[model samples]
Structure formats: structure tokens, C-alpha cells
Target chain A: MVELVVFVLMGGGALAGGVTVIKARNPVYSAMGLLGTLFAIAVLYVMQLAHFVAAVQVIVYAGAVLTLFLFVIMMVGVDKEEDVRETIPHQRRLALALGLIAIGIVVSLVARGRFAWVPVASAAADPQATNGTVQALAEPMFTDWVLAFEATALLLTIAAAGTIALASFRRPVADTAAERTGV
Target chain B: MIPPPEINWFALLPLLVLGLGAAAVLLVDVQMKPHPKWLVRMAAAVLLATAAGALLQGWWLRRLEAGETVGTPLPFSGFLIVDRYAIFGTLLLAAIALLGLGAGQRFIVSLGRRAAEAIALVLLSTSGFMLMLSTPQLVMMFLGLEIGSISLYVVAGFSRQERQSEEAAIKYFLLGSFASAIFIYGVALVYAATGSLQLFEQQELLSRVAFVKPGVLLIGLALLIVGLAFKVTAAPFHGWAPDVYQGAPAGMVGFMAAAAKVGGFAALARIMATAFEGYIETWATVVAGIAVLSMIVGSFLAVVQSDFRRLLAYSGVAHAGFILTGIVAGEAGIGSIWFYLAVYTVQLVGAYAVVAAVSGASSAGSPLASYAGLAKRQPMLAHALTVLLLGMAGIPLTSGFIAKFGVFQDAFRAGFGWLVVVALLASVVSFFIYLRVIVTMYMEEPLEDRVLVLTVPLRLVLWTTLAMTVVFGLFPVPLLRLTAISLPL
Candidate 1:
């Protein structure tokens, strides 16, 4: 009964947050809605006993990523109302139809009772259940997936260097000197 | 406690060399004064060395196979597979990077101080794609894709002074992230269905199980196709290609396009042929539908594009359709697909080299008018472009014809005769598009006295690509044999 109640509340909150993210005129409001949705999803993850994933979702996504989004929104100055004119012909209608089709497909599959909302537990104790803790995750990450782990370091370095290269412009020496002299 | 997975350093040498080269280039850039030419030369040397490493690995694998081998080696707990396929992909990616950087020298030099960063990003992107080609695990492939894609997003915006470049980067980033998310969702669904992330393990599990709930697995497969299709710029998912190609700096656009195609298609082929082999009947028809749509849409669209870069983007879509036709034949067409990709990428880079020379390297919006009287003003570039365009159009006595024939034959053998017929018609229409450009260059009078000068590196790229095109057209036996040898293990 507690699980049922929690699922209902979190799912409702997630839906509302997603709607607000789409409908809100202000960029900051949209970002806030996104944060709410993320938090609700994190709660859902926790309900699934994925505590590590839930914590990371809260910390990395709701905390860090949402904050970055807000910072960008503020820097870009979200005072003006966005232009809501449709650029492509029939884009909204097409999107609506496609969305309806996708939802229908999912609903029909669920109606057929072929799509399980929760994973079926095995007769034996689940290895993954015991290994859901941080230590178990870290063991495979450091051992079996070590190459990928090291490769992530390279990816991050490349991203850092690429960001600096794309964002920072080096003016000619003459321009720098002139600017320094208040020209 | 679980035992630690065994590491195979020899299998990973090519990627390691590339990573070290990227770091070395960045460090060298900081320590010494920035000379774009010197940095490009250094990057080229690094790429050449990396390619050499890949070749050495290939040679070693052949020796192993000859001496004694029951099955292909799976290194890193089956996260990576070392075989002729991976080596071929790595060597091709390295070569494409070298050619792209070589052709992009003036553009990098134009950046003044950020040349090293540009070079490093190219190497990093190449390594990412190389890793993607070598991996057998879905998550590892995703990481490789992200690594390559994030670098490309930045590279797209390298000309920061231009509004269009920034727009292109933002568009690419938002859509790319969405696609990646969809791909991961598919991965999660597949895991839910089969309880495995490794491709081979998933195959085994799938074949063993009756799959009481197949809807989720089918949806997962569709999502995988959608994500990969978006990357390869297949029709309906190809909205970003034209804008991004037209907006990105001309010198690097070829590399970006070629690298992404090589990696994305390599992964797609592997996943379809290896993991989803049991569901060939289900996927083959779906792939055929996409192929038909892409060909029709790409051909008609190419005929209408006034911008040369956008035309090439559309042509790329058409070529992707051709390759997908081969893929629809299942594993039998993997060799044909690789051959098509290898030959097409070389010609693509060569064609873009001409564009980079005609338009300034950093400039966007290469209107077809720029090529007016190209033959009169710059005869050699015009000739090179003529050959390249002919190759792209699949004219007789060019490598493109052989590639088209191979794929069509594969599709026909697989009972996709209707698709092959549609593809032939699309190819003919696409030929007209290429012909239009050729006519504009040769027949149309000069708009202005725009001096088209080819830099030495650009010259080297063009000559090599051209020579390869002609040689492969005349004698495809060697390349055909090589591609046949590179099947996924």
C-alpha cells in the first residue's frame, strides 16, 4: 500500500513537472520544472531500490545539471517572452499525431499484459540485488570496465580542451596591448 | 569476491597511441609558440604512427590465425574484440583523420592560436570512433559514440565568430543528446528483456529464451535503429546534416562527416549482424523501408539544393541509403558496406578539399555559384573535383560504380530486388545533381576572378584520393579481397 501511494504521488508529480516544462513561457520556469521532474524520477528510482542511482540522480542531475541550466538561463537573460511562432508547417500537428501513435502502442502493449512494470524475480536470490550497492558497482567498474573507465578520463580531457578552444578567443597581441592601455 | 578481468594491452595499443598523441600535441602547444603548420605536421605524424600500429596488429592477428586459433580473441572480458574488422575500421578512421587534418591545415592556421586544440580534438575524435568500432558491449559503444560526438559538437562551432556555426553546434548538441538518450533507453529495455548488456551474451540469451514478452525487445530494436539512423543522417532523421555541414568550417566538415559515418555504420552493422541476427526477418524489412525512403528523399532533395555543401550532405544521405540496402541483406553484405564506406569517404574528403580551396577554409554557405568557371580559373582543382563527383555519381570506370554494384547485388541476392531497383533510379537522379555541379563548373561563365590555390597538404590528399579512386575502379580485386577478410568475428 505504501509503495502504491508513493508511485501514484511521484508519477503525478513527474507528469505535472513535464507539462510545466513544455508549457511555461519563462525559460527559468521551464528549468525549474525540469528540476522537479528529475527529483520525482529520482524518488521513483529509490522506490525501485536503486538507491545508488537515485542518489547520483539527485546529486548530478537535480543538483549540478539543473544549476548549470539555471545559470545559463540567467546569463542569457530570460526576461523577454520567447517567440512561439511555428517555423515548420504542420509541425505541431505532426508531433501530436506521432505522440498519440507512440502512446497508443505502449497502451496496447500494456493492455495485452505483455509489458511488465516490474522485473520478475527469480526463485534464487538475485545476484544483482546484492550487487546493487556502491562497492559492487565500483568493483566491476574498476575491473571489467577498467578500459572504459580510463577512456572516460580521455573523453573529459578532450571535452575540456575543446570547450576552451571553442569559447575563448585569443586576440592579436596588438589588440590586447591597445585594450590594456584603454584605447 | 569476483576476480579481476584480464587486461590485454596489445589489443589496445592503437587507441593508447592516439590518446598519448592527443596529450602530446596539447602539451607541445603550451610549451612552444603556436605554429599551425608545425602542429598539423605533428598531428599527421601521430596519425600515421597510429595507423602503422593498427597495421601491425592486423599482421599479428593474421599470424595467430595461421598458426593456431579456434575462435577470434575477445579481450577485456569481451568488452572489445580484436579482429580484422576492428583493425580495418581503425586504419580507415586514422587515415580519414590524417586526410582531414591535412586538408584543414589552412583553416587551423587561420585560427591563429587554437590550432593545437583543433588537432587534439581531431585525434581524440578518431580514437573515440576507433574504440567504438572495436567494442562488443553496448555501453562501451555508447561511451565511444558520446566521446566522438561531443568533440564533433565543439568542432562544428570552431568558427565561433560566425552565428551560423554556433547555431549548428547548438542544434547538433540538443538533437544528438536526445538521440543518445533514446539509444540508452533502448539499451535499458534490451537489458530488461534479456538481462545482458554484452552483445554476444544478449544474442545467446535471446536465442535460448522463448521471450514471453517480445514487445519490449522489439521496441528496443526500433529505438536502436532510430538512434543509429540519426547519426548516419538517414532521411527523416537527417534534418541536422545540411545545416551543420553548411555551417561548419569547410576544412573540418569532411572529417566530421566521414568519421561519424564510419563509426556509426560500423556499429550499426555489428549490432545488426551480431546481436540481432536471430531477428533478421523482423529488421530486414524495416531496414529496407528506411533505405527506400532515404534514397527517394535524398535524391529529390539533392536535385534542389543550391548550396554545394548542402548538396553533398544530401548526397551523403543517398549514399547512406545505398549502404543500408546492403545492410538489409544481413551479414552477407557487411563486406560490401565496408567497401562502399571506405571508397565513398575518400572521395568525400577529396571533394571537400576543393570546396575548402574555393571558399575560404573557415567560410560557410558555399553557393553553387562559387564553382562557376572553376575549370577556367583552376584547372587542376576542377579536374580533381570532376573525378570525385563522377566517383560519387557512380559513373562507369569509377570506384563508385563497383560499390553500387556490390551493394545492389547483395540486396538482390537477399530478395530485396525492389529496393535495388528503387536505388538504381535514385542513383540516376543523383547523377543529374552531380552533373549539374559539373556543368556549372565547366559551362557557366566566371562570376568573379576568385583565385583558387591548393596548399601542399590539400594537394597530397586530393592526389592520393584520386589515385585510389581510379586504381580501385580499374582493379577492385585487391580491395574486394581485403574487405572480405575483415568480417566481424
Candidate 2:
């Protein structure tokens, strides 16, 4: 019952936060809404015993990603909201209607008990067997995923060096006649 | 303490050599004040070493097949699979990178102090694609694809002084990221459906348990196809090729184009043949449809392109279609696929080398207008372009013809006869595309009295490509048989 209560609260919080992310007029509010959603999601991950993912969710998403979003919002001077007029005729009405239809489908499906809240039975899918802790993740990451882990170094190198290659403001002798002289 | 997984160092030699080489090039660039020429030579040596590593792997694989104990072929827990296919693909990519380094010597030289960066990125991208070609694990494939693609994104915009180069970089980066997203999502869906990201494990699972609902799996497969199709620039997903080709430094365009196609086709062929073999009825028809569309669209659009780069880009699209013809046959066409990729990519680099010669090394846009009477202006280059263009057009006594013949025969035998017919028609139309360039080079009056001062490196690249095209066209047995052993995925 406590699990059910926590699930309902967190799920509702996530949905509310998602709605606010789009509906909020202020950019800061939108970011706050996004943070709320992220936190709710992280809480859900914790409930699933995917503790490592939940930590990453909190650290990466809530801390780093949301901070970046806020930074951009501040740097860009975030008073720009769309004019509250529909670009398309009845876009808002149609969106509302579609949203209603979506919610109706979900409600009907839930009422009919059609949703499989639990996943299929599998060794890999068992939360108790393969808890998403750092220790649980470490073995495969080093052994089976070792190549992928190593390849990420290459990917990071590309990112670092590629940025410098593209953004570096040094184009010395880009089209000099030395090329013509074959010197 | 858990024991570390066993790693076969022999299987990983090529990738390690390339990774270390890339790091060395960057370090050398910063530490030593070497001339751009020396950097080019260094990069070339690195690519050659990469090829040598692949050859070593090939020799080792041969010994293993002969009942010699050299350790497990699938090392790193099956993350890296070294086989004839991997060896052939690695050799092909490394050779192209080497030739590309030779062909783009002028472009690299133009960069002056930054030449080392370009060389390092090239080596890195080649290593990435080699990984993509060799790995059977889907997540690893994604990682490899990103490594190759992200490097090319930067390379595509190497001449940042040109506005179009920056535009090309942005365009390729955005579209490529989207394609990468689509690919990872596909991988996720496949994993969700099958509980495994390794293609071999997925195949075993799929063969064992017949899923009542295979919708998610099929969608995942189609998504994978679309993502790879974008990389190979097959029609309907080829919107960015012309712009990117025209805008990127002409010297490197061919290399960039070939690198993606080679890796993309290698992975595509393996995925279809190995993992989805049982679902050939479904995917084969889809591939045939894509092949038909690529041919028709690539052929028709190529005729109208006024820019030489754009024209080559469209012809490349058509070639992508031609290569897809080989894929439609599933397992039987692997040899043909490799044969076509090997020859066509060499021609691709050579053609762009000529373009780099005509245009300045760092310039964007080689207007077709500039090529009028190129034969009168520069006979050697005109003749060189003629050979490569004719080779691309699949004329008799050229490697293109043999490549086309091998693929067409495979498709026909695989019951994709109609695809072969469409491809043939497309081939005829594409002939006109190359012929147009040839006529512009030979028959038309010179737009300007510009002389091409052919460097030794450029000359060497041209000669090497021209020699390969003719030699393989006439005596295709060595390459054909070499490719045959790389079969069955």
C-alpha cells in the first residue's frame, strides 16, 4: 500500500511537471518544471531498485543538465515567450482534443486492466537478481562491455579534437600560392 | 576478486595501432615543429601500418582455419570478431585512408600548422569505421559509428574559412546526430524485444523462440536500415550528400564519402545476413525496394547537377543503389558487395583528387563550368579523369563493369531479377552522367588557361587508383576469391 501510494504520488508529480514544462510562461519556471520531472523520474528509478541509474539521473540530469539549461536561460535573457495566439487555426483546441483522446485511451486501458505493469519474466529483467548498483554494473562494464568502454575513449577524443578543429580560429595560409608552386 | 576477461591481443592489433598512431600524430603535432609534408607522410605511414595490422590478422585467421591453435577468433567476449570479413573491410578502409592522405596532401599542406589535426582525425575516423566493420555487438557498432561519424563531421568542415564548409559541417552534424539517435533507438528496441544486444545471441534467440508478435523487432530492423541507409546516402535518405560533398574540401570529399559507405554497408550486410537471415522474405523485399528507389532517384538527379561535386555526389547515390543490389541477395552477395565497395571507393577518391586538382585544395564548389576543355588545358588530368569516370560508368574492360556484373548476377540468382533490371537501366542512365563530365573535359572549349601543377603524391594516387581499376576489371579472380572467403558473415 505504501509502495502504491508512493508510485501514485511520484507518477502524478512527473505528469504535472511535464505539463508545467510546456505551459509555464517563464523560462526559469520551465526549467524548474523540468527539474521536478527529472527528480520524479529519479525517484521512480530508485523505487525500481535501479539505484545507480537513479543516482546518475539525479547527478547528470538534475545537477548538470538542469544547471546547463538554467545557464543558457540566463545567458540568453529569458523573457521571450511566444505570443499567446495560435499560429494555426484552432491549434490549441485540436491539441486539447487530441490530448483528451489520449488520456481517454489510457484511462480505458487502465480500467480494463490491459496494461502490463510488470515486464516479462527473464533472468536479465529480474530486479532482485541484477540490481542496478555500481557493483552489479561493474563486472559487465569491465568484462563484456570493455571494448565499448574503450571505444568511448575514441569518441571522447573525437569530441575534444573535433571541437578544436572546427572552432579554432587559426586558418594560416589556407589558400596560399605555395600550394600552386607545389613547395 | 573476479578474473579479467581474456583478450586476444592479435585480434585487436589493427585498432590499437590506429588508436596509438592517432595519439602519436597529435603529440608529434604539438611537440615537434614538423613541416606539413612530414605530417602527411606520418599519417600515410600510420594508415599503412593499419593495413599491415589487418594483413597480420588475415594471416593469423588463415592459420587458425588450417587447424593451428592461435586462440579464440571471437575475443573480448565476442565484442570484437576477427574474420575474413573484418580483415577485408579493414584493409579496404586503411588503403582508402592511405590513398586519401596522398590525394589530400595539398589540402593538408594548406592547413599549415593544423595539418596534424586533420591527419589525426582521419586516422581516428578510419579506426572507428574499422571497428564498426568488425564488431557484431549492436551497441559497439553504434559507438564505432559515432566515432567515425563525429570525426568526419569535423573533417567535413576543415576549411572553416569557407562559409559553405561550416554549413556543410553543421548540416552533416545535425543530420548525422539524428541518424545516430535513430540507430541507438533501434538498438534499444531490438534489445528490449530480444533481451540481447549482441547480433549473434539475438540470432540464436530468434531462431529458438518464435515470437507471436514480431512487430517491435521488425520495426527495430527497419529503423536500423533507415539509419544505415542515411549513412550510405541511399536515395530518399540522401538529401545531405550533395550539399556536404560540394561544401567539404574537395580533397577530402571522396574519403569522407567512401569511409561512411564502406562501414555502413559492412554493418548492413552483416546485420541482414547474420541476424535477420530467417526474415529475408520481409527484409529482402524492403532492401529491393530501397535499391530500386536509390537507382531511379540517383540516376535521374545526377544528370541535372551542374556542380562537379554535386554530380559525383549523385553518382555516389546511384552507386549506393548498385551496392544495395548486392545486399538484396543476402548471403550469396557478400563477395560481390566487397568487390564493388573496394573498386568504387578507390575510384571515388581518385575522382575527387582530380576535383581537388581542378579546384584549389581548400576551395568549395567545383563548378562544372570550370571543367570545359580540361583535356586541352591539362591532358594528363583529363585522361586520368576519363579512366576513373569510365570505370565508374561500368564500361567494358573497367573494374566497374565486373563489379556491376558480380552484383547483378547475385541479385538475379537471388530472385531479385527485377531489381537487377532496374539497376541496369539506372546504370545506363548513370553512364550518361559520367559521359557528360568526360565530354565537358574533352570536347568543350577551355574556360580558362589554367595549368594543373600535378604533385608527385597526387600523381601517385591517380596511378594507383587507375592501375587498380584496370587490373581488377580484367583479372578479377584474385579479388573475387579473396572476397569469397570473407563470406557467410
Candidate 3:
């Protein structure tokens, strides 16, 4: 009964947050709604004992991504009116059609067999169900996935260098001088 | 305490050389006042060394095979596979980078201050694609894809002064992220279905386990195809190609298009061969369908483009269709795909080098009017372009014809005779697109008598590609043998 209550509360919160993110007129409000949805998802992850994923969800999505969103909103001016008119004819209708198709696929598969929806072969492929922890993740990161881990360092370097190349003007000496003198 | 995975340093030589070489170039640029020419040489040397390393590794693999030893060295717990296919891809990508950078040398020089960053990004992107080509695991492939794609995104908008370049950057970035999301979601679904990230593991599980319903797996496969199709600029998902190719700095566009094709197709081919080999009946038809669509769409669109760059973009789509036809043959067509990719990418770079010379290196548009009577003034460049364009159009006595033949034959042998027929019709339609350019160059009167500056590196690229197209066309036996041996099978 307690689990059912918690599930209902979090699931309802998530759905409401998702609806608000799409429906809210204000950009900031939409970002907050997104945060609410992400937080609900994190809580749901925790309930499933995927604590590592939950923490990552909170830290990365709720914390970092949401902050970035708000910063952009601040810079771009959150007071501006957003145009919600359809740019393409029948776009909403098309979207609704696609959504219906996806829902139909899900419903039909679920109705066909529970195993059809469920990942049945996953059990035989990997029966290990260790609690989500740093050790569980770190082992693979340091050993098997070490190349990918190191490659991320290069990816970050590219990101930094690329930003510098893109944002910095061609004549840096003149630009820096102008900036320093407040010209 | 657990020990670390066994490392094979030699097997990873191509990646190490390219990545460190990129960092080294950046460091050298900042530490001292290096000449722009020196930087170009430095970049060229790095790519050449990478190609040499790949060659050495291929030789080593051959030796291993001769000894009847521990087969298919999956270094780093199968994260990287040291096989002939990976070696071939590594070698080909390195060569393409070298040729692309050489062809774009004038543009690099014109960058003036940001030359090192541009060079470093090329090397880094090549290394990323090399990693992508070699990896057997999905997570590693995604990592490599992002590493390659993010760098290319920045490079596309290198001419930030142009609104078109900025628009291209944003469009590629946004659309690319969607494709990546779709791809990773497919990976997640595949993992959910089989609880494995390794393609072969997924394959083994799929063959062993008879699911009550494999709807999830099928959907995952479809999603994977869609994602890769976007990368290779296949039709219906190729909206970004013409704009991005037209808007990007002319120098690097060739590398960008070719690198993505090389890496994307490598992953696509490997995944289809290994993981979904059990469901060939389903995927083969779908691939055939995509092939036909791309050919029809790309060919028809190419005939209408006024911009030379946009025409090349559409032609690339058509070529992508031709290559997809090879994929319909499954593992049997790996050699043909490589052959097609090799000839096509080289031709693309050569063609773009001409565009860069005629239009400014960093300019957006390559208007067809600029090429009006190109042969009157710049005969050598015009001739080189003629050969390359003929190669692309799959004319007789050109490398393109041989490549088209190899792929069509492969598809036909694989019961895709109808696809081959459609592809031939597309090929004929594509002939006119290139012919239009040739006519504009040879027959049309000059718009102006202004001389075009042809750089040494650009000349070198033209000569190399022209010779390659002609020589390979005439003596295809050597390349055919090499490609046959390069297969993962």
C-alpha cells in the first residue's frame, strides 16, 4: 500500500510536470517543470534501486542542464512572447498520428504477451543484479571502458578548443586591446 | 583486487599517433611562432604516419594469420578489434584526411591565426572516426561518433562571418544530436533485449534465444538503420547535406562528408553483419528500399541544383544510395562497399579542391557560373576535375565504373537484381548532372577572364586523385585483391 501510494504520487507528479513543460507559456516555468519531471524520474530510479542512475539524473539533468537552461533564458530575456502557431501545415495532426502509431505498437505488443514487452533474454544473458554503486560502475570504467574514458578527455579538449576557435575573433590582439580600454 | 585488461599498444598505434599528434600540433603552435607552412607539413606528416602505422598493423595481422595464431585480436576486452577490416578503414581514413587536408591547404593557410586549431580538429576527428571504425562495442562507437561529430560541427562554422556557415553549424549540431539520441536509444533497446553491448554477443543471444516476440529487437534494428542513414546522408533524412555542404568552408567539406560516410558505414556494416545477421531477410529488403529511394531522390535533385557545392551534395546522396546497394549483399559486399567508398571519397575531395580554388577557400557558395568555361583559363585544374567528375558519374574507363560494377554485381548475386537495375537508371540520370558541369566548363563562354590561383597541395591532390581514378580503373585487379583481403570475414 505504501509502495503503491509513493508510485502514484511520483508518477502523477512526473506526468503533471511533463504537461506543464509543454503547456507553460513562460520559458522559465517550462524549465522548472522539466526540473520537476527529472526529479520525479530520479525518485522513480531510486525506488527501482538504480541509485547510481538516480544520482546521475539529479546531478546532471536536474542540476547542470536545468541551470544551463535558466542561464540561456536569462540571457535571451525570459519576458519575450513565444509564438506557438504551427509553422508547417498539419504538423500537429502529423505528430498526433505518429504518437497514436507508437501507442498502438506498445499496446498491441503488451496485449500479445507480457514477455513480448519484457526483456526476456536479458535474464539468461546477464543474471547478475548487484546494487548500483560506485564500485559496480568504476570497475568497468577503469578497465574494460578505459579507452572510452580516456577518449572523453580528448572530446573535452576539442569542445574547449572548438569554442575558442568559434567565439574568438580572428584578430585577437586588436579585440583584446579594445576590450581592455572599454572601447 | 582485479587486474587491468591486457593492453596491445601496437594494435592501437594508429589511434595513439593521430590523437597525440593532434595535441602535439596544438602545443607546438602555442609554444612557438611556427610558420603556417610548417603547421601544414606537421599535419600532413601526422596523417602520413597514421597511415603507415595502419599499414604496419595490417602487415602484423597478416603475419598472425600466417602463423595460425589467436585469431581476431579484440584488444581492450573487445572495445577495439584489430582485424583487416579495421586496418583497412584506418588506412583509408588516414589517407583521406591527408588528401583532404592537402586539398584544403590554401584554406588552412588563409585561416591565418586559427590554422592550428583547424589542423588539430582534423586530426582529432580522424582519430575519432578511426576509433569508430575499429570498435566492436556500441558504447565505444557512440563515443567515437560524438568526438568526430562535435569537431566537424565547429569546423563547419569556421567561417563564422558568414550567416550560412553559422546556420549550417546550428543545423548540423541540432539534427546530429537527434540522430545520436536515436542511435543510443536503439543501443539501449538492444541491450534491454539481449543484455549485451557487444554485437557478437547480441548475435549469439539472438540466435540462441527464441523469443515469444522480437518486436523490441526489430524496432531497435530499425532505429539503428535510421540513425546511420542520417549520418551517411541517405534520402528522406538528408535535408542537412546540401545546406551544410554548401555553407561549410569549402576546404574541409570533403573531409567532413567522407569521414562521416567511412565511420558511419563501418559501424552500420559491422552491426548488420554481426548482430542482425540472423534477420537478413528483414533487413536486406529494408536496405534495398532505402537504396532505391536515395538513388531516385539524390539523382533527381542533383539535376536541379545551381550551386556546384549543392550539386556535389546531391551527388553524394546518390553515391550513398549506390553504396547502400552493396550493403544489401550483407557480408559478401564488404569489399565492394570499401571500393565504392574509396573511389567516391577521393573524387569528392578532388572536386571540392577545385571549388575552393575557383571560389575563395572560406567562401560559402560555389556557383555554377564561376565554373563557366573553367577550361579556358585553368586547363589543368579543369582537366583534373573532368577526370574526377567522370569518375563520380561512373563513366567507362574510370574508377567509378569499376566501383559501380562491383557493387551492382554484389547486389545482383545477393538476389537484388531489381535494385541493381534501379541503381543503373539512377547512374544514367546522375551522368547528366556531372555532364552539365562539364558542359559549363568546356562549352559555355567564360563569365570573366580572371586567373585562378592553384596551390601546390591542391595540384598534388588533383594529380593523386586523377591518377588513382585512371590507374585503378585500368588495373583494378590489385585494388580488388586488396579489398577482398580487407574484409572482416
Winner by DockQ: 2
What overall lDDT, based on C-alpha atoms, would model 1 receive against the true structure? 0.89
Local lDDT at B172 for model 1: 87
Chain A TM-score by candidate, in order = 0.73, 0.73, 0.71
Report the C-alpha displacement of residue B88, candidate 1, in angstroms. Answer: 0.8
CAPRI verdict on model 1? acceptable
TM-score, second chain, candidate 1: 0.98
Candidate 3 residue-wise lDDT, A51-116, digit = tens: 688899999999999999999999999888767788999998999999999999889877877564
Candidate 3 C-alpha lDDT tens digits along B1-489: 657767778878999999999998899989985877789899889999999999898878878879955655787887888888999999889989999899889888878778889999999999988888898899888888889888999999998766788899999999998998999988888888889998878888989987789888888888889988999999878999999999999988989999999999988998998888888889999999989999999999999999999999999999999999999898999999999998899889889988888888888989999999999989997898999999999998999999999999999999998999999999999999999999999999989888898888888998999999999999888988988777763
Off by over 4 Å in 1: A1-130, A170-183, B1-4, B68-72
DockQ of each: 0.36, 0.50, 0.41
In candidate 2, which residue ranges exceed 4 Å CA deviation? A1-44, A76-115, A118-130, A170-183, B209-212
Error of 3 at B268 (Å): 1.3
Model 3, position A16: C-alpha lDDT score: 94
Ranking by TM-score: 2, 3, 1
User: What share of the reference contacts survives in each candidate?
Assistant: 0.56, 0.73, 0.65
Q: Which digits, one per residue and each the tens of the lDDT, describe model 2 over residues B1-489?
A: 557977778889999999999989888888997998998898888888889999998888878889886577788988999888999999999999998998899999988777888898999999999999899999999988999999999999999888899899999999999999999999988998999988899999988988899999999999999999999999889999999999999889989999999999999999999988888889999988888999999999999999999999999999999999999889899999999999999999999999999998888999999999999998989999999999999998999999999999999999988898899999999999999999999889998987788999999999999999999989988998998888744
| Candidates ranked, most accurate by DockQ first | 2, 3, 1
